[model samples]
Target: MNIEFKKNKLSIALSIALLTNLSLMAEEKSPKELDSVTVIGNENSDYKSKEKVKLNRTKMDIEDTAKSIQSFNENFIEDSQLQNIENIITMSSNTVYNGDNHGRTNDISMRGFSGVPILIDGLKVTNKMAHPEVYNFESIEIQKGPDSLQYGESSPGGIVNLVKKKPTKETLGKIELEVSDNSSYTPKLDVAGSLNKEESLYFRLVSVLKYDEGWTNSNTETNKVFIAPSLSYDVNDNHTLTFMAEYTDETTPSSFGTYVNSKGNLVAPIKNTISNPDEEFEKTQKIIGFDLDSTFDTWNSNFRYRYIDYEGDNGNVHMPQSYNEATNIVSRAFASQKQEFEEHALQYTLNKEIDILEFKNKISLGADYNKAYSKLDMFYDPSTPYLINLSHPSYEHLTSASEHSGVMDMSSDKTYVESWGTFLQDSIYLTNNLIFNAGVRYSESKPKNGQRSDALTPSFGLVYHFSDQTSIYTNYSESFTPNSQEDTSGNILDPEEGKGYEIGIKQKLFDDNLNLTAAIFKIEKENIAELDPDDPTLSKYKASGKQESRGFELDINGNITPNWSIVASYGYTDTKNKDNNNLDLKNIPEHTANIFTSYYLTSFGLPNTYIGGGAKYLGSRYADENNKIKFDSEIIYNATVGYKKGRWRANLSVQNLTDEEYVDGALSSNARGTRVYVGTPRTLLATISYSF
Candidate 1:
């Protein structure tokens, strides 16, 4: 027989044997309910989440986990009307909104580290150029510090995991429409139901369409379409499979926001843009994946696979090079790029619980493999200088690749990366009050054009429970990230390494409805790729730099009363470049705070009505590595009123209640002046939703 045929024959034989065994086992076992689907909504629709699934590759109570984990459920996302992942960062601790990189990347800084990885479920998203849509996700989980044991080759700062909505056993449907003051309209649909009377097979479909006119004077319109469908099948009482697919197509302005002059003052109005009218970014992403869960006599196993295809086109982007404040003229260069990325990932995990030496031990073992290929085609028009008078900007003279013609420089390249890892973990219940956890992972990364790197990372933790409602924990973890930069000698540098230490306390009050946590952490990173001080040309880099970040964070979430819910966070971060005379890191705020609370009007005889308001404070931050330019602290306020009766719900939200003028993020600074992102002005959004 042919090799391919032989493989297929073997697969079929294995499937048949497995089914036969399951059938025999079913005949001998008693009838039981099928495994429950993961639910995102908490009891009473509260803001707090009781458990996290991605942290350990298994659902576990947050109080029992040694790491610092924060969860925002669907209720919070709906109440806040979060549009994307960037909005969720504001409510998190020790995080900075680093602006979407001209609507091309999810630029964010977590715990003083930039470029944190984003995951769907437990798998990494290879393409980071597009922002993740929030409508399809049921919850967002932020895992602080190094989590390399579960996720390989990630920034030590943290990882963000988006939990997707799953098929429900009961028939349900929801329709919603939203209108914003900025001439934006959105319609969304969500439906889920069981396919059979036995409820063993189920399906869900979610979709959203949005159109928004330009918010600024420039032609910065936005359009988006997203659809996701999923299915869940129970092969038997001991096995389950879930299939998921997603499609997204979106276009948004590739705006650089406002600019700052030499005197550190904003040069343009909040609603004005310096970008060309025709500049825009477009992206289309598609994903298909499946998960298999199995329970054997002695262990439980999970297998997952995902394939992703992404394409992005960034139109002509104007990059300011130099600004003459006295002449009121800004010189810029133009560039356009198109990227294509495809990725395939596979993961398998097994878990078992047993007693060793009379001590209860939960052991977990897993392996994962990921392969990705990317191609980039770029065109630059640096030879043709494009100058614009900021005092009276005109788009007629804007330069694009088509305009430059023969003067443009073109380049194309293709690259691929293959990575694999295996991890083992054990959680030991030493006693009723004390628990110990240990894990180790061995990972390897091989790039098509770069050197191969491998590492063995370890994590250790201890948790002590004072009572059922209070606990204290400490953890130490290490992270490894392969480096692609090269020195002047054209040699790839060694991988970056990180070490993190944290201690925290957790408390539950109000009958476990309210959860509070406080943590202090220190992170040390080495082998950072930085500009070679010796390389005067600024074209080479060296990986000899080191950095450190130490911080304290406090988070509170849940209900103060049956009718009152609150979510609050505060962080104090101190970061320094150990190799650069202890200079403060750019855009890393020293103090950040947020608080949002809502109260139902049940006492006022309107149980269906609620009023909520909150404020976000971003502390002073430096715009550059030299710390010569600083941005003052700013506080923005927001409010919302919501009412629901029967199957109908309505909400009105007002953002930037005071029309605060502030810098949301600093992208970069140079002789051309500072490229800063401005905060959104006062805006209103109204939403009406119906459920059946």
Candidate 2:
């Protein structure tokens, strides 16, 4: 019931900003918080005076570890203006982001599971059917279970890491302007630098551009471009080096077609002016990544590389009553679909920080290699309008007859996959309050057509420290996932294994400006990737060994009162379908929660106005998999208004403030027609910013 009001609205607004930043960092000891952690950071910056973080050193951290996790930082994305990453990734609390006609692609799920796996900076830019974004992030980690030991045949109910954004000597940067009413326009730029002369060389660059006219009718729109650059070097005093690069290209116009279909699926029957699908689905992907690091004293070394290519296409039915219901059965009007992906990977790691015999050690070792390729293309047009009447409930899609007007000529193909890996981890302290962690990973996969998947995953953990504020931890892990790129006659689909358990607790009451964490998790999966009793319609897919999930999480972040702050979260899920306990695992959701608070009246007198609000709850869902059909549960609210001075800032935003229409993502009533994508009905955004 009301999920315990997400823990009394984040423990009473973080017990009043954690007793006012613990009485101002315990007064008289602030050199800007030790000069923002000693003017610079690295070696994960000794975890910056740590409070909770060390999910296997950079697997990711911000709060307590082992399952159920979340973080936003950067003062909750500049006090919630949340510059996209799909709006702070649904503000965690059991993530979900429904809409996807597959343009720039967006479709995710975490507690209820849906191939959830994404990483950047930690690599593995997801894809069994791609969709990635977080537009050059600098922090954003959210996990829940079996974090696939952090991606190894991944996705066991959670994982989303998008770190990027390195290179800092603090020349802090920001610049922006935006407008929306469905006639979008945006421009943003960021810069940072501090080179040589002991600044140890550093650099940062971020850029973005957008154009829109979306909210459709028949010539839809959404265009984008992005660029990023990063570099850091410290060559001596222990040796160090790093370099990174990014590029993005996006084009949108095809928001999936076959227009409106009342009872079979597909909605958005025109209510705005734009493209009605007349055919146009475009996608372009290019990414080059690298990072090399070295340090000596106790040992640490690194290497990572990435390359990706994405492709796209479409013209299918394009609306017009789905081209008059597939051209009345014989003269096909249009149809074509395409998909492609390519990737190359490399990884190397080594770490050691020992105190040996005295009993204090930290060690990690790694190895990796990967090569992948995928492809698909289909077309139709049996006479021009295609042969409809197959129990005609208004059929649609049918074209690509080699380019239209031919009947069944083109159908491309391609698939290749390979992989290798090794890993080991350790972190034991035993005294000073107890600390322990363990790990193991081994993977080997091959796929030309199938067979040859090996795995060895293991993990353990513990962290006590009851007093210096608080602490408690536990972890158990195992993971695997590999298999995709065969189906449609080539076979191959079996490699989805998982096992995980976690318990957590962390607190810093008062001092350290507030931070709390609570977690519970469980995961079980096998084979995964479903549908194939022999011919589940032909595009062929299989791998269902079973599946399972369980969860609980709550997190509240920093600076409760130094000026009022809050970053909330909540999640409770119990996914199923492990050999039909009553089948229903299509869209997932048991209960989800989210809340974000803001306070800072400029010392209360309200100078340059600032106010905040947030609420989100989603439950009751099941729209396929023998559950029949359903999707009735919703709660949403958000509000914000702000003003800042000195470097200039302004804002106004209101989203789904109870004007909710719902359907954060939908599709799967046995598939084939009746597409849907909705969520974002009451929107009004405006922005301005500057910093030099």
Candidate 3:
């Protein structure tokens, strides 16, 4: 792996040298057709695009929003073959896959915090533990920092929004088949067109089937089936309604991953080997939603409602003690549980534009309400023996881990949690080049057996444009989440609170074909609940906890020349637990970066041919809270070559071309122990598609 990395590094240097000499060649190409070279999408140029409504619940350009945001469109998704959220984060700056990747949740972490929620079409549809397929969505949007004013009660890191594909009046669709080197097969179908002759109604249907036979020792197999159907109706010139439904069923192996030996390497007898290949889990998930949009002379409004349900049963194997180097063995135990979850949510927004004494103003008001319930039952027996050997394993011994004596051994009991929030924001243009923004939200949460808590959060921002292509901005925001913890008397503790501040400058050049943004930010939190220092078994709570984080991020996107397109970013973050110097957050790389670029080869008599590659670098990160064990830094390189002509396209992509061994996820210490999931090796994916 080390030799491969060195070779790739040399290649990267040579590629840069070649790019530096392409200026003369770029100047000779026809500029007229440059507009047809789409990178993100067809809506706007590579440097500047349409306003994002998720920022302030109103249409506002990126320069006027005074916050950090990143977006990936259809073109990028297809070119990169980003099948899941984990794949997206690998190329995303300052982001880490915090989740264990247990085939359940797409848990992401940024700026040292974890479990940021994922929203679908502006509505919170599922909890943090669900990982939905991305093929059904048209684009992905990420809003960094505290966004509680727009989306309520989330980690200060940020939020992700998946924009679903809507029904189009024009008849258009595509069918695609994909195959990978990992013994995976996938077939997909998508079609959208007018449902009525008048073109007032439209519908779209998408379905996909996949089967993946994973690595050898990992003992993991995943099979999935997904279907989504949607319909849209145009009631009048100013009103529209859309309905959408999705269903998914999957079966996968359940395990916490492999133990990291004292040498800091994953303990695998050989690649693809699994210590517990027989343990498995099955799950089913469903979602139904609708949206209503209306535009009036004075204002525009939108309403969304969704319901989600999930059921699954999983068997887990836990290794408590560290692996003995001499014996090459680790002691482990097994358990099984059945769980269910259901949630319903509704959201509404109203936007108005008005002129106040020569100042143009945009105001938005919104509300969100949601209720969730979950239940779990576990099978256990004191008499059952549970143990396994790493070098030598057997399913017969593992069966003893799920023993039950006629009745369920334990349960989490039935629990219900409800939350709601209301917010109002105003963006006032004090002058043609100056803008001021202010917003506030009132949020509350109620537990089935604890006291309800509510609070008010606020935010403010200012932007000054120097010209059509340059601007400077600053902002401050606050966030809060009610704690579910209770003392001996059964009273809820205070809610966690966060305050953040940011300042940045943005610029565009070469007719808005190149975009650059740089920002520095700081966040502080209070009222963080934690366990009593004196007691480890009999737990006690304290609200007097503190944490602080500071960081700087730089992002560049769009085209450098008529035929050259690029997306790149760099991030530096420092985080600390103020009250406890011994603890640090896990899986957060202090320095991370990504850069990918593609150039159309119109000069070599191959007008539709293109080749591109990029590198991702991650700094060393700790696996345990105490920072005793650390994973070394790594750099992975990838390349792609493809051709597009008329309506047909074919591409071959190689990820981790160097076959670098790395760790992408680490489970923090608990009763079980610390274990890490090995990163994927060099893999190849080939895709072909035709669109009408």
Best lDDT among the predictions, by candidate number? 1
lDDT of 3: 0.73
What's the count of clashing pairs in each model shown?
0, 26, 7
lDDT (C-alpha, whole model) for all candidates: 0.81, 0.62, 0.73
Worst 10 residues of 3 by lDDT: 36-45
Pairs in steric clash, model 3: 216-272, 216-273, 217-272, 217-273, 217-274, 218-272, 218-273
TM-score versus the correct structure, for each prediction: 0.91, 0.32, 0.88
For 144-262, candidate 3 gives per-residue lDDT tens digits of: 77768987887787777778778878766566667899887666767777878888999998877766776555455677778899999999989999999989877666645666655
Give the CA lDDT, 0 to 100, for residue 262 in model 1.
55
Candidate 3 has a TM-score of: 0.88
Clash total of candidate 1: 0
Residue 322 Cα positional deviation in candidate 2, in Å, after optimal superposition: 31
Give one digit per residue, the lDDT tens place, for model 2 in 1-692: 45334433443454345335534543545656434332221111011123232233433243323445665654466556554564576677667766564454556777666666666656665442233334356566666666544347776666766666678876655666666788776666666767665788889888766666666544535555667777777776666576766666655666542322323232333333112334455666776666777777778777778877777755464232232234322122454667788888887778887887798767778787878887777655545433333223333433334555455646757887788777777777778677787878878888776677777888787877777778888888777777663565666665677777778887875566666778777777787676666875766776765777777877676656655667777777777787777466766777777777766577767756677878878776666666655667788888887777665677787777667766665543433333445555666778776554
